[model samples]
Target: QGVVDPLGGINTLWPLFGIGNQMLASMALILGTVVLFKMKKQRYAWVTILPTVWLFITSMTAGWQKIFHEKPSIGFLAQANKFRKGLDEGVIIAPAKSVADMQTIVFSNQINAALCAFFMLVAVTMLISAFFVIRRALRSDLPTTHESVVTLRNKEVRHV
Candidate 1:
């Protein structure tokens, strides 16, 4: 096994970064939900809740996988060195020489029809969700005035 390096450690941090991003997204979604609902716009609030709920779920799942699945394909640097050992003794092809190489081989075929379909499904769902939010935001019935005042001293101040 080679000596551990700083660059390798950084390479394993993508899951942590994903977890942080999802958490921030969840927080933003919650804030948006509250602000929109308090502003008396239920449609917009509902839009915010959809992604918030998804973000929370995905973050929790990532957290679980981080703690449980520490395999080379998942992110355990200590065990990664053994990944190439699992390859059968030479039949005709050379075994994956290293963990990173093996991981690439494992996932190299991932972009198949099923994966493409799943990606398309997710994209379509996102597009539909965005359309709803945009439509609600553009509705003329929604209140436009941030502040409204009525019955001032012999005058009226109204935000329109």
Candidate 2:
């Protein structure tokens, strides 16, 4: 590796990132509903609150490396050094390398991750609030017969 090419990690794991992102988004949708359906407000609050803290920690750890100009892992660093030495000896063909390029790539990914966390937090909060609102509306005194009635549309009658 040289001091000119960056984004080695991105080049390797971009596909995996896309797949993982899609899975996480789906999980959030399901988990958000689980929190929303809790009859107790405290349960709903706790469900959303804990994950927010977890995300904060994850974001910080992932983002901190970029902020501090740290390498990915000890093994990765060792391998990169070996690769660079091989390239210098004309035994391997590798692109130029730059720490700045790596940091920029990490920063972009961290930003995307933070945004995803923010969206999940927002969705969970909205679900909690919506549940409370609906629960309150349901609790209001009303005629039981009127509340129990189910109206069918013309399309539904045709299907029947």
> How do the predictions measure up, each by TM-score?
0.42, 0.34
lDDT of each: 0.50, 0.44
How many residue pairs of model 2 clash at the backbone?
A: 4
Q: After superposition, how far is residue 29 of candidate 1 from its true place, in Å?
A: 0.9
Model 2 reaches what TM-score against the true structure?
A: 0.34
* Clash tally for model 1: 0
Model 1 lDDT per residue over 53-158, tens place: 7886776566545444556445343233333244343222224455455554333322121333343345345545655654565574654324547878989877
In angstroms, how far off is 15's CA in candidate 2?
9.8
Query: Top TM-score: which candidate number?
Result: 1
| Candidate 1 Cα misplacement greater than 4 A, ranges | 1-7, 70-160
Least accurate stretch of 10 residues (summed lDDT) in model 1? 108-117
Worst 10 residues of 2 by lDDT: 142-151
Residue pairs of candidate 1 with colliding backbone atoms: none
